[model samples]
Target: MVAPPKPIPAPPPVKRAAALVAILGGALLLLWPAVLNGYPVIFSDTGAFISQTVVPLMIWDKPWIYGPFAWVFHQHVSLWFTIIAHALIVSHMVWLLGRVVGWGSPRRHVALCLALAALTALPWSVSIVMPDVLTPVAILGTALLAWGWPALSRAERAWLLVLTPIAVASHLSNLPVIFAVLVLALLLRAGWGVVMRAAVPLVGAIALLLVTNVVGHGRLSISPYGSTFLLARMIADGPAQRTIAALCPERGWYLCAFVGRLPDDADEFLWNQTSAMNRRPDGTAIFLGGREIAPEAREIVMETLRREPGTVVMLGLGNFLTQMTRSGLGDTTRRRDVGYGVIPHLRNGFPAAEEARFQSALQQRDELNAWALAVARVFPLVLILAAPFALLGWARAHAARDARALGLLLALLVGMTGNALAVGALSGPHPRYQARIAWFLPLAAVVFWRPRPGVIPAAAVPDPARSHTSPG
Candidate 1:
């Protein structure tokens, strides 16, 4: 007489403990930055972002998507929800990294995540209130979709779709990074045999951007400031100086009137209220036509480049290189002048009893900035080495049919390079821009990293059906 097979018993205590540590410890690590700050740290843009939820208005300098989201959390629950939600995303990446490595067991996965939490700057991404934290998350999600989609479960695929768009919509910079990865994914599909729908998330992000803009800014464009930003960078460099020197009297461009007053630093010109952009008593950007005629700014940029092509190339190269090497405080300008700027006015909108939450971070800005800089010095070198190591692993894999192995390396390189270009090119070199996602360089390399004989690669088990599938 036969009996139905008994259901398998649940995993034992040690295995359960390993899983719990992986999740809880990983979250605490992600939340470490907030813990250090005494509360979720606020950037200069925090008030503006929160405005979208409270005032529901669009900001010219930053995206509105994050504002409403954090606003909802700040109002309905607590601002801590913002930190909690962010930590969850980072923890998921730690889990996914473990899965990709094919670690021998749960304990191994826990070990890897703990190592990353302790060694990498990932917590900064999760701890900060800005959307900048999502940059690495987006790159990792895109790489997973492109390189390991076949091995992912159905639920995982759904989450990828959700995560990627949130990332792309979170910031204008993310769109370029995601798009570059998508293009790389297509190349892999065509040349390496990988199969996955890379464009769905991108399209979703673009659509979301348009919709959010329409709702907030009353427009369908990505942002009204692109041309202005580019123009600002060009003006900061030498080309705009030369162009103004030759054409100001003949062309009647407003910048000609204040050419001698311009600063050599581009960011200062764009961000500092006393800079040349405020040539007019009205406080409008004369070179940017008050930021209303972006096309005119674009024309000036092109004219400058046409006149001195080498300057554009050199400026871009310098900006990219500078950005790659540094990591500084996110909103130093706001911290320096918190006493009498827009903040006191903005504080009026804070939820009751939370008006003082950001003061601690403000007071300790110098100490924290120094702490970050010290930690940051090592990351650039680690990131710089990551690409070559990935190439080395691909070369050593010796498994020619393994498209997944090569695709991963390519995705990481393209994503990081794209981030550098989008941020440094359009916004100019600021260490904070590059630091947001540079850690991915070394982290991604670890995912596709190869181990020699007798040294088992630590990652998740490969699904039997996917073992023979080409990764491209």
Candidate 2:
């Protein structure tokens, strides 16, 4: 009764080879900074992750996923493999984005990757051996799952379904970022089919974390030490200090012993070995002792909220606003002196040969310090100036009926805001906290600037009224 449907043609071998070359080149581009440094970048938290992998023990604060991830790639041999994995994974995601936006050509993919490497903090995140790189990947993956599903090939869809959950499970903060994006999609009426499809990774991530925790610690929780972080945030922001001062004589909390002398910074309160929580009056250091008072910390946080709700809200809002504008590279790129920051952890986790290479790295020698500091000063200013223009571009894309671009823009906006709120409002605002994900802003801008017209696959463009059917 009808003619047979036409099958989609495949790329020729020459084009396929070219595309493969571009992906490989893009992966190398992502790793250029680390190559420049002569060693993979390390952060203060890098050692914690390394210890978790080498010793194969769980830390109270961070999730156990990244440690095993590192181990799987590195095989306890060298950290370079882990960083290389970061590059390859991100490059593949970039290529996937290109396909969704009707620019799946090798040349375009290479150009986009080059632009991102040069303009954004993405290279820095990739070079570093931390889970921070996964934040953007998870966010982007969720967007693709929600609105770009129809555009993706079956194999690509399967890859994201597997990769997204792993990315989400890599960090505690990522869970909230993914949830916020999904919620925003629903609020924008992305439809139940879209929301449910996007939510697959979120559910899988949650299940992975719960199952891992239950197996490791006999606890079915996301973060057993979460209360300590909340307490640290409250104390740093002044509400917990006020709460402790008022409730001490009545409640006799453990934190009362050093009421007036507590460090006013959340990081110091949580990680400074010299702080009262970590060091006793006898001067014996109990690094990260906040874990011991976690239950009490929860009580303190609840009481602080009950007593000073307005103050808490105001301070949290202040932190969130500050975090939104504080993206920079210095914190992640600066030199960490021996016996301090990441050095001790590296020394403890790796063999002498590895440590020798690390000691001679550009970061340890302070060779890139000035450049990093300069970037720290300029990058945030650039982002602040670029925000309104980015919004305008997104509006233009929406007006043009470019749902693929619109979906991506929305994902980056929501993910960045969620990251700020989750980290800044609760943990405290740090330049690195925002810098880790700020790359998405510039990446979003590129997508807006370069999208081709009338070339996006019809199936890829979401239908506003079609809420009943799900894309494969």
Please list the Cα RMSD from the true structure of every candidate, rounded to 1 decimal place. 7.0, 5.6
Which numbered prediction scores highest in TM-score against the true structure?
A: 2
Candidate 2 — which residues are off by over 4 angstroms?
1-10, 337-352, 375-378, 381-385, 455-472
Model 1 lDDT, full chain set: 0.64
TM-score of each: 0.81, 0.90
Clashes (N, CA, C under 3 Å) per candidate: 9, 0
Query: lDDT tens string, model 2, 388-463?
Result: 7778768887888776677778888899999998888988888777888897776666666556787564222112
Model 2 accuracy (lDDT, Cα): 0.78
lDDT of 2 at 415: 92
lDDT of 1 by residue, 1-472 (tens): 5552232233445544454456555577667667766667666666666666666567766777777656545563346778767776676665665454453345554555565555566666677667887787777777776666655655556677777777778888888888888788776563332334556667777888888778766878787656777777877777777787788777777667776666778667766666666457556545433355465666777789899888788888888777666554455323452334335434666554455556556334544666555665666466667768766666754365456656666676777788888888767877667767766666656665663333223223222123321110
For residue 289, give model 1's deviation from the true position in Å: 8.1
Residue 142 of candidate 2: its Cα lDDT?
Answer: 89
lDDT of all predictions: 0.64, 0.78
